[model samples]
Target: MWRELAAIGRETSTGGYRRYAWTAADTDCRSWFRDQAGARGLSHETDRNGNQWAWLGDPAAGDAVVTGSHLDSVPDGGAFDGPLGVVSAFAALDELRSRGAEFTRPLGIVNFGDEEGARFGLACVGSRLTSGQLTREKAYALTDADGITLPGAMEAAGHDPGAIGPDPGRLARIGAFVELHVEQGRALDLSGDRVGIASAIWPHGRWRFDFRGEANHAGTTRLADRRDPMPAYAETVLAARRAAELAGAVATFGKIAVEPNGVNAIPSLVRAWLDSRAADRATLDTVVAEIERAARDRARSDGVDLSVVRESFTPVVEFGHALRDELNRLLGGRVPVLATGAGHDAGILSAAVPTAMLFVRNPTGVSHSPAEFAAEDDCAAGVLALADVLEGLACR
Candidate 1:
């Protein structure tokens, strides 16, 4: 399975990956999924939001048991983050079939679109829309780095943006959702476990900062006469770092671009994206407010106009405890309960369904980069854990 993922990774040269939703790479990945599902004799369908679901039984069955994850990756992202769950889901299904475990309730495997928000600036787009967590109009208005509106992208991808909305009819069919993902942090490594169950996801949000200033020739323009926004941008980056440290949260200025980005030109504008997260809503709010204040102050001192726009916000999510207990029981206490700071489709689905997650240990305790890893043994362990959970949920 890792070989298949690695093969896909070899096709991209961008630092991690650039498989934004609806992009060529993403489309290719979707095709790969379709072929895989078809080979397994699973019936597949694409929902209005572009999410793909493959079923092992009757699709009309209400409250079907579902599992799977996204295929998109962050730029130059590691091979495991989203695809691991998906590959493991397939592996588990194969294992179940090999064991001849007859399942009465319907079983589904899904691949949610734009879960990384790498293209449209909104994570979990498909799941959020399907679960009524986000409105379609707002989703349509979202734009990519190149200013392509989400609606246009959707249409180009052969999905009607007008058709995107809460998919109650589709959602009603899912009784529970269980996602198996690679641990994005050091929790499992610190705890000495190969597999763990997720207890919650930290509150998180993304914000975009636009700083406007005068664009001028870098070589001819005197530094004092330039109203370049770069200074303010730099200050904002430092301020975000300081603010996050003070608030005991995480704030990152990972994406930035300068208009007229020429070595011989002073940028007219600077755009930066911030991803912030914390244990609770209050801390998240405080961190965001402080970052905004710092940006405003920096902009004023630097004489650059500024504006902030919220891209997405997801509050801390607590998974169903009853489900967690059941999973633990099924796993025989071998798998530990863990909390994640990363965002997930499961977090959005939790609003409308009983959602849970199982995380496989990353020996390196790192994620979102090419360095991320999960041992083969741990991968198989995760599959076993997922199968156990699915069996219990399906039986119940």
Candidate 2:
């Protein structure tokens, strides 16, 4: 499964994949999913919000157990972040079929679109929209880096933008959701285990900062004569790190856009994105407030205009206790409990339906980059673990 998807989107020289949402490559993946479902004789359908689902039995039947994850990637993201859960679902089905496991309930493998929010700047957009967490109008108004409206992109991609909205009918059919993913850090590795159970996802959010100043020729503008917002923006970036460190939060200024984008011109507008996560709501708020205060002070001193807008915010989520405990029991209580700094579509679905996550050990203890990795044995272990859970949930 890794090799199958690795061959799709562009691969960086660093060995990472760049499968942005709603692009040709993502479309290719959706097609690939149809092929996979066709080969398995599982009927598939695309939801109003672009999520794809392949069902083993009648979807109108009683609530079904759902598994799988997104196929999209962050720019040059690691191989396993979103794809692991998806591939493991396929593998688990293969495992179940080979063993002739009896099934009394319907099962589903779902592929959610844009889980990373790498393009739309809204994480879990598909799940959020499907569950009514975000309004259709608000989703349509979202803009990409190139200023393409999300609705326009949907239309260009052969989808009805007007059809994008909450899907309570679909949500109601899901009995539970299980997402298997590569651990973003070393929690499982430290325990000498192949898998871990996610206890919760820390409260997280994305904020955009727009700083405006006078644009001037870099060579002609003197430091004392110019009011450049770049310095203030840079200072705010550094301040985010300092504040996160002090508050024990995770903050990153990973995306930015500078107007004129040239070495010989002073940027009149600087837009930067801040991704932050913390243990609780208060800590997260305090850290973001500190970062904003720093940016405001810097902008004041530099005589520049600064504005901050929160693109999205997800509250800290604890996986449904019953399902989590069941997974722990199924794994023989060897799985470690860990809270993730990263967000997942499972976190979003947790609010609407019971959701849980299984994390395979990553040796590099890194993610969102080329350095992320998992041992083959660990991946196989994750597949086996998922199959065990599926047997209990979907099999007679």
Candidate 3:
């Protein structure tokens, strides 16, 4: 499994992996999934929104037990974030077969697209659309850093953008969703546990800031006369930090681009993106509002035009209590229940169906980069936990 993931990693130039949706790397990973599912004799189909589902039984079976996750990765993202869930789902099936476990209800392994939103600027694109959590028009208009609209990219990738929308009928087939993901934070490590059940996902959202000013020669432009955007941009970043700190949440100004970026040119515009998250909706809203106010104030004082647009917003999600209890019971012990700040396909799907998550320990307590890790033993433990849960759920 590591070898397969490493192959995908090798195809990327940004350190770890960059399998953005509809990109060559993502397409290759999709093919890899098809090959794996075929080898297992599972019938496979791609939904209208491009989600891939491989089934072990009849498709018409109502409420099929489903497990899996996304395959796309952030730029230079670690090997485990998305792929571990997929690899573990396949491995769990193998483990079940080895143990001769039988099921009454159908079982499905799915590969949700664009969970990272690295290309389209909207996370959980497949799951959210399929679950009716996101609208078609909003999704189609989303653009990447290169300014290519999502619809154009979808067309380029041979998927009809017009087909994207709420898929309640398709989602009705899933009785429950259980996603296995590498723990992206220190919670599991602090608890000293190999496996955990997710209780909730912290509220989170993304915003884009565009600051416009006059471009001028760096050497000739007098400091007093210059209407440079960099100062306003810098103030906005600082405001974000201060606001997040005051609100007791987290905020990041990670992506920035300066127009006329030449060393000898004063930038005419500065564009930055902010990712903000908090334990509750109120805090998240407060932090975002504060940052936006600060940005506008700075822009006005600096004679720079400003625009702030919300890219995506996912409220704090509480996993199905019944499903979580079942998973805990299957483990035969008090599996710690934890909440994550990270957004996931499971979080999006929870709006449509009973959804839960199992997190494998990340020794590094890190994700979205090459340094993320899960031990071989921990990986195997995750499969066992998944198998146990699947057996219990499928038998119901």
Candidate 4:
């Protein structure tokens, strides 16, 4: 599965992947999924929100114990973030099936679509839509960087846009969900373990700050007369860092756009996004409010117009307690339980169904970049652990 997926997507010059959802690369990945499932005689179907599911037994026989993850990638994202969970899921199922393990209940794997939202700017779009967290209208109206609507993209890709919406009936088939993912940080590395269990996800969100100023030529504009928004944008970045540091949180101004981007022009507008996470809702709200206030103050001082809009917010998610306890006892590793600042489809699905996650140790503790890595031994161990968990859940 690894080799097959690696061959379809664009590996950037920097060594990361560019497998945006609904694109040709993602289409090829889906085809690969269908072929793999077909070869195993597993029934495969796509949900209303584009999530793909492959069932080992009858899907309608009973609520299935589902395991899997997203196949899409952030632009230039690490190879393992989404695909590792998916590949591990397939491997675990293969192990169980080969061993003559019988699952009385349905056992299934899923490949959720648009989890990264690299093109549409809405992370976990597939999961969110499936769980009714995002409305169909909002999802269909989402636009890419080039102003292409999501519906337009779906139509062009041969999918009916009208079919996109919340799917309670489809979601009802998931009795439980377990996702085995590559750890995005050094939690497991610090503990010297091959795998860990996720306890919760920190409250996190994305906010856009737009700053506007007068446009003038670099050669003609005097420093005293110019009201460039760049300085305010810089101040906003600094404010984010300060807020996060002071509040014991995390914030990043990762995406930015400067309008009239001519090297010689002191331009009109600066749009920057703040990705922030905190341990609690109150703390996160406070940190964001402070950052916004700071940005506003700096904008006023620079005579720049500023507006802040929240694009999305995922509140703190606690994994289903019973599921976590069962896995802890069933796997019997005394695996470390961790809280992640990063979001996942598992986290999104936790809203509707019981969801748990197993994270394979990432040696580099870096993600969303090319440097993120997990040793083969650790990956193999993760597959074994996931197989154990899935077998227990599906057979019990």
- The candidate scoring highest on TM-score is 4
Q: Is candidate 2 or candidate 4 better by TM-score?
A: 4
What tens digits encode model 3's per-residue C-alpha lDDT throughout 1-396? 668767774434556887899877878888889988999999998888888999999868788999999899887888899889999999999998898888889999999999998888778999888888778878877888788988788788888888888888878888989999999998888889999999999999999899999999999989989888999989989999999999889999988889899899989989999999999999999999999999898889888999998888998999989999989999996899999999999999888889999999997788988888999999999999999999889865
Clashes of 4: 0
- Identify the runs in model 3 with alpha carbons over 4 angstroms from their true place: 9-14
What value does the lDDT take at residue 387 in candidate 4?
92
Clashing pairs in 4: none
User: Which pairs, if any, clash in model 3?
Assistant: none
lDDT of 1 by residue, 1-396 (tens): 556656664435554666778877887888888987999999999998899999999868787999999999887788888999999999988888777788889999999999998777788998998988889778877888789998898888777788888998888888889999999988888888989999999999999999999999989988778888998989889988998899889999999988899988999989999999999999999988998998899889878999999988998999999877878998887677888899999999898888899999998887878778888998998998888888777754
TM-score of each: 0.95, 0.98, 0.97, 0.98
Q: Candidate 1, which segments miss by more than 4 Å at Cα?
A: 9-15
Per-prediction CA RMSD (Å): 1.7, 1.1, 1.4, 1.0
* Candidate 3 lDDT: 0.89
Model 4, CA-based lDDT: 0.90
Question: What is residue 127's positional error in candidate 3, in angstroms?
Answer: 1.0
TM-score for predicted model 1 compared with the true structure: 0.95
Tell me how far the alpha carbon of residue 254 in candidate 4 is from the true structure, in angstroms, after superposition.
Answer: 0.6
**Model 2 lowest lDDT segment of ten:** 1-10
**How do all the candidates rank in terms of lDDT, highest first?**
2, 4, 3, 1
